[model samples]
Target: MYSSIELENVEPRELEEEAPTLLSVGRELKPEKMRPNVWHYERGEENAYHRQGEQEELYVVLEGTVDVTIERDDERDVITLSKHDVLVVPPESWRQLRAVEESRVLAVGAPNVPDDGMLEE
Candidate 1:
């Protein structure tokens, strides 16, 4: 049986050493309710790198504003999201985002296993 569901103050961690950065929170710390190898990510930055692969992805804006670009099935679209806005991308789609203003975005997906995601390069 699970002991607790409370992950008190689930603070973001740093890179390499977990210095309290957002990547850590996004990369690690999967809640019990989520899928195994789930990807729960939060970006508090001005820009994000582009990536694509076999898994699908969803993005949720927490504050401010951001723009997401997606490519799939020979179609391309740019989506702008404000606080509380959400966007979903299908598997095999390429995507990237840019912060129009200081922003926080939550990105979630499944099978975030190492081999499921890829970079264009």
Candidate 2:
């Protein structure tokens, strides 16, 4: 069996006014091993810094640009991604994404574990 959806047809999740619009593609598709989400961010908006306990995540820039800040141990790095760029983040790396322009990104996490994320202040 297979599932398909046009991204524009997916409903966006209701979140804080400052938060990016989120579309849960995996929720709609009912994937067993992966969670896929799409994020629509306005320029200058950002997500919280957070890390997963056991699920690695992949981020793909689908439109515009974003800066991904990753912190591990005591070190930090920022990587800029334009359309079509991709980044794979390990489970324990603290990371956040800021929109450099109005942007859309696809994030997918493997193993589809519940409550695997811990957000930082």
Candidate 3:
């Protein structure tokens, strides 16, 4: 069971219009072995501010440290994660990811509601 692309191999696409470091990989590497999931984001950025609407998400910090801020209901919280650390964001909670240094982050979410993720305005 292997479906892989060097995440970094994703060529220049319309996504470069969004962010040079953002690569839309979930569709291109859909694994037949697993249920469809909302796109998996392979990000190499200093920070990313966004959130999921209908699905909870797991943030896997592959390198460096990331400050995760989640805003829900009327409260907000922040967590610091380093290499190998993982943070789970519940549905509808607003989240912001800021890398303390050059970093790689893989965000995974289940049951593809492909259109449910929205970036902050």
Candidate 4:
């Protein structure tokens, strides 16, 4: 789904040192129930898998492209997303993002509160 201009004003933060190199433009729009925050992850030499607890996400590709594997419904699906591509992740979905090319994205969802629910280690 497309985001409304009013609701899309949220900006994404760059999370390099910890992640990779990329631009994220919607750092705020996280859901109330999940604790919302946004950040962008760039492509690294290595790939990683990640998931958030009980919360869903809408990742809209704002620049470049990336290869992704989304694990859901007891299965794994691979897809390549590029500019303007929007991906919706259902609750409890497991996902891995690998930069097939370079990529930039917008992560909009809850911040994953309760501390234990976020993808941070």
Where model 2 places Cα greater than 4 Å from the true spot, the runs are: none
Candidate number with the higher TM-score (2 or 3): 2
lDDT of each: 0.56, 0.92, 0.64, 0.58
Taking all chains together, the TM-score of candidate 3 against the true structure is 0.72
lDDT of 4 by residue, 71-108 (tens): 87689899988889988886577786766555656655
RMSD of 2: 1.3
Q: Per-residue lDDT of 15-92 in model 2, one digit per residue for the tens?
A: 764379899898899898999999999999899889999999999999999999999998999999999999999999
Once superposed on the true structure, which residue ranges of model 1 sit more than 4 Å away at CA? 1-21, 26-28, 31-49
lDDT of 1 by residue, 22-88 (tens): 5334334544433222122344443334454555667777666777778777788888888899887
lDDT of 3: 0.64
Worst 10 residues of 1 by lDDT: 33-42
Q: Which has the greatest TM-score?
A: 2
lDDT of 3 by residue, 35-111 (tens): 22222223444334666677777778776776788898879888888889977788788887766666666777765
Candidate 2 has a TM-score of 0.95
